[model samples]
Target: MAAVSRWPENVVVFLYAVFFFHTFSSAQRDPGYTFMHQATTAPIVSYYDYIIVGGGTAGCPLAATLSQNSSVLLLERGGSPYGNTNITDLAAFGVALSDLSPTSPAQRFVSEDGVVSARARVLGGGSCLNAGFYSRAGHDYVRLAGWDARLVNESYQWVEKVVAFQPQMKQWQSAVRDGLVEAGIRPYNGFTYDHMYGTKVGGTIFDQNGHRHTAADLLQYANPSGLTVLLHAPVHQILFNNQEGSKPKAHGVIFMDANGLSHRAYLNRGPNNEVIVSSGALGSPQLLMFSGIGPKEQLDAHNIPVLLDQPLVGLGMSDNPMNAVFVPSPQPVEVSLIEVVGITHNGTYIEAASGENFASGTRTRDYGMFSPRIGQLSTLPPKQRTQEAIDKAVEDMQALPQSAFLGGFILEKIMGPVSTGHLELTSRSPNDNPLVTFNYFKEPEDLQRCVDGMKIIENVIESNSFSSFRFHYLSIVTLLNMTASSPINLLPKHANASRSLEQFCKDTVMTIWHFHGGCVVGRVVDHDYKVMGIDSLRVIDGSTFRNSPGTNPQASVMMLGRYMGVKMLRQRST
Candidate 1:
């Protein structure tokens, strides 16, 4: 009996050795899955080579890449993605989307001062809960930012390989494809092989083995050597070196744990190492202001002591407005994962991966941007309400040129013409969440764009592809009446539409939560992603985008994060 007990003890020692040795081992082989089993706790005050804040879309990749050559500590504000009830399950995600209250980590960030904020709190940040759409921005948009076209294009390509984005080819089945074609929806052939602009094709897929690919999956491929992922570590403020004569340096960060305990991690494992803030659009800006890095007047109004007066830290706010037209399936199409998978396999066709082409040319469409037709509407003021304004908006959307083969297309405008919103400090208590007033649709022109977007949806429904389906023309009035003062409601006056399309157009508006702009790049941070007024403090996330890509912002965010990571690694080596 004594001998048997000794064998058990020896086995335990062997396992321990395996973990200890591999923890510091070379990057050639797989690291035992022991790191994945780490318990959620506040990070210890150990010195790390790099300390990345936020484990969301960009932060996850950033941490993973940096850790390849150095010790990295990633801090996240939410719990692990493993057992989160609201995240792992697909139906649960849909339920989360429909819920009025902000319960999911991503939804919770949208509120400020007891209101819903757009930032997310989770191990994977926005990627954990966002609609898994892997698409890129137009080349023109990148060139417009004064970026070398070749460099920007190369960056796009490099990141695409890192993520290994594979669209759902099976979703493009015969039945769905034939139905779309017969209904006059021209297929966008070679979308994955060439320039995606003007290519009318089916939606791309972002899942593997029927499971959605979140940031966690992307990080897994990065194979970080000495990276530690810390969940439930919400960053409240950035600690800056405020000595009068020295350069303003980012030394550490103040964070609160799930149980509300205070913790801090110095950059470079000291009071002088760099701090990378990948907290995202809503998150990074709020943190900057709290750390005294924004407009002086704005910070003072919120009672936040001034640390730096970088006026553009959170000023260039932007997001796409979404107004969805829900049309029930003609037949009871199963809404399960299996059914979605079956549809893909039998519907349209697609490539397994785009190889080199994945990095070049815009090859997709996001149901977010309010098609190019509604340009200049963002210049309107917030309160100048009028029906003529709405009418003009509708006309602009209707003018979007559609191929003769495709009857019409839906114009989902996420970035409205009116851009009005500001970031304000909600509390000086580092423990309290920052106050964010995204002010969605505060401008009348924004509301007008919503109305126009809906009109476009109505036109798309009129196409033959949907004609045979159980579809109905939702008059603008009916739409408003059905959902007024509701986050889901795009139009409010539709309740009063007198059966006339013209009458319906006079009222109704909606919003699509494709948020962007705050802490916008170029204006907020230097070209290398360092915060303008602070040394050794960099922000690489969606907030650093030069402009809201006229499509989904996920791909853009990921690319930017990857680029920043490469830049940081190069600088550190020097």
Candidate 2:
């Protein structure tokens, strides 16, 4: 077990929040978000010992760790996430989207299979948008990845010491815990970061003030002299030297600035100098495909030069298929985020959040997702309320009647889904979203797992632990177990299924946004995470993951960055 930091909890809530804001705004002092230099300001050419693509959840930590001893260039396509309440404050759900930055962090996309999902386009990546749940990857994951166990523990400790915190459990979350236990998940493993089968209160990245501490916050540990972070710099292509009788070597990358100006950054002349792609699952594969490293047939279709015919580059794509139900609370539920999780043995995970709004934890009754509340608006002065936002709010209010106000969400997502799909490039543009389809519940086992999970959820809703929160209908008999009138039923009466339970799972299928794969180990990359058939190139993000590890992948992804960095530094010394 890792030595869990006994760092004083009360001190961190305000200390880190204030520290991050003060240190980040100076814009030139640290290798932090405030030190964000626009790509246009960069020279037409530059050199670094390491060029890291994607300053995301894993990228940020990886680059920060590498910068301890080597000159590193970190490039992010999106802008900073410093002052955005929509992204930062846990209680404030989707208030409004600002034109504050030229690029917004949430890049919305619709997959080929007609499922709507959004990829993070900001510096902290999905960590800025996730539920902030933190749990270690399972023991099986460590053995399978062939990671050094002692170093893995140390890596997790390093990140936890800086970012992860024990959450102050809230009302809705507490009830969820009891309900999970009531449903017979297992013995409670209270207040733990270790992944275990049973109800457990895991660490959270959100502080007591409801402020989010993301993977980007880990940059505080970076060496300022050795790191240069560029924002709004999307890579166009990875420049490679493909000489005959040698493996293709990644030399540099071409990236576009916010001004749409192109710039080049190259790896310096050193045997160990490398270009690492830490872009998320989707972005990493897409970038490789853009740089002529995918299937030969797909490259020919786009007229791209084939650097490597790595057919497995964009294969084995899977998403933990998620299904959720809105539990309408008769009384106003206090705004709460995910603090409790149930690790069931049947390959299913149950977690939940409460709020008045569409974002994680909100409490409200009468507006669309973007509807601007007068009270919330009044908190800010007149100038802070942009005309665009008011107009958007008006538009939302007009569309408000069609939308339903949610009390809270209790969700179940299958872990390590057996049903898989693939990702294909949509166009040649690096920024264009590729076509991805998870084919949710396509396999019989997957469908059966979801159905079984839903049954557990139904048990949770009816359990004695949730009696206070449960809505009692004195007038009509509440038929929770009946197929005809289940409170958890989201599907129409006539949807195709052997029963309404399976139909409910099918109709309400959604993405928890835990999509991983495309560049999996043993297939696209080797055991060491170095890309096969290529030199001086490696992928260290969720793209290489065969599955989203633990309750959430953020902790493991961040840990992998630090762990690999330590390993590489040791290798260099030897």
Candidate 3:
């Protein structure tokens, strides 16, 4: 035995040395380096503890959060990851990525048959491609819409933590801030946890590491365990059992993968199994109706066989319509995000005390914060203090310092009059995308408010402050449709003379991508985020927001997804 050991000693040492060297070399190499392998076979049906539909703004977060402890199946209709410099960093440069052509696949769909839908369809969903603004909505809007302060506040905190939403390091630009100040519209950091009205001035811009923030950062950073993020998997219809009851209980979902192949999966419901819908406003409702959970009349028309008589499923589609009246910048606005955040807290607190000035009645809500007043405005008498506050806010915003270049602006016209829109199934073929119409400016007051908002912007641009900047107006072709031109063109036009004041004001209607209230809380899902009238089903996203919050909705949606994930986990624990 001693003689044999001596002979093998050198051989063992050599093998061990070679193994260590290979392992060390492998670890030192680039992590992303891999032999590219083409996906040859289409993936067949797979089961999971949780199934989340949509890969957009809300869905991505939901999947990332839920899959933290358990397996999650995230399905997106768009292609694989295609990261661009602008899409990953600058918030202002995201929309422009669409022009990259050939590389930026069309994740959006066409509604009204001919009209294109601006919703994202890829893996990171809309977050991968949204204007990386992390604006929080006013608390009042959440409470008014039946959500308690506890839930809303928790949601806010959850989102801020997950996304690490830092305010702009520097002020957006003194010109825009000063212009608002000139308008008597005190700039209030709109993301403040309180008031959305009153005599305030200035606000914060959301950014990430000196660049514009996106959900991709959060999801990738979190790195949920046992989660499969499969892009190009568009859900066609939810499979439900008719005999279950009035509201059909969803059995599972059917989707189309990247190769246009059909696949299906089933959910067991409760305990380990749960299904969630975070498919944004348009996609969520369409999924419901196709699965037999919408207005009876509409469902029957499309031969979807009603599962739940949810008239409100797709009836309350809402979006912020803006008349972005670009004013000439003395110089191109080139402030970095780090510089922007540095000023947000300073700006928010500086004007916090003025929030109460816009209060009406008991002043139960924060006045200085950006509140969603349009929902309540219609109820206020034309002479009431609430209406007065809106008017004053609009007036002040118009007169803001460098009002034309204040980074971004919000006015009454953008809130809009509440109007109904349809999300009807385009064909019995559930694989196709549903039809959507925003029906902007449905009410006479809405049109009038737009005119007023535009007039204010026009007045601000023509003001003495904008004298040094070059300007142009939106093209006639762009005005007729929101999807006609990329959002890239949104800032080009500064001169009112380029288009008649009436044309610029009347024709220009743009979306802030703040769609909400389609699958509202009460009508579609319970406050617990569970789908009403269905078992083992839930909705957690902007689509579940019963009403439009008073500001950017990304924070709120992310919060809701987190809340739902935590609650579901806790319930399972018991």
Candidate 3 Cα misplacement greater than 4 A, ranges: 1-43, 80-82, 91-117, 162-172, 187-195, 198-212, 220-223, 242-247, 269-272, 335-413, 428-433, 455-504
- Candidate achieving the largest lDDT: 2
**Candidate 1: lDDT of 86?**
41
Sorting all predicted structures by TM-score, with the top scorer first, yields 2, 1, 3
Reference-based lDDT, residue 204, model 2: 90
The Cα RMSD of model 3 versus the native structure comes to 14.4
lDDT of 2 by residue, 147-187 (tens): 98999999999999877889988677788899999999888
Task: State the lDDT of candidate 3 residue by residue for 160-239, as single tens digits.
Answer: 65454534423233344444445444443433433344222222223334333444434653344556666656677887
TM-score of model 1 vs. true structure? 0.69
Candidate 2: where are CA atoms >4 Å away?
Answer: 1-35, 94-102, 358-406, 474-498
Clash pairs, model 2 backbone: 27-34, 355-361, 355-362, 356-362, 356-363, 356-364
Give the alpha carbon lDDT tens digit for every residue of 1-574 in model 1. Answer: 5765667787978877988764443222223433342223645455577778888878876777777677777887665565443444333333333223423554434332122224566666666555454566656667765555665566567556644344443321223333434433344343341223322222222334223445654577455457877766777788877788877887777777666677777766443357898877777887788888888988898777888887877765655544333333334322222111101111111111100010012322111122111111221222222335434654544553322112111234534335546566666653345545555555656555555445444444454544543336655344334323223323344343323322232222222345665776678887777787678888888777644663456666666666667766776777
* Number of the predicted model whose TM-score against the real structure is largest: 2
Q: Tell me the TM-score of each prediction against the true structure.
A: 0.69, 0.85, 0.68
Worst 10 residues of 1 by lDDT: 351-360
Residue-level error in angstroms, candidate 2, position 218: 0.6
- What does the lDDT come to for candidate 2? 0.76
- Reference-based lDDT, each prediction: 0.52, 0.76, 0.51
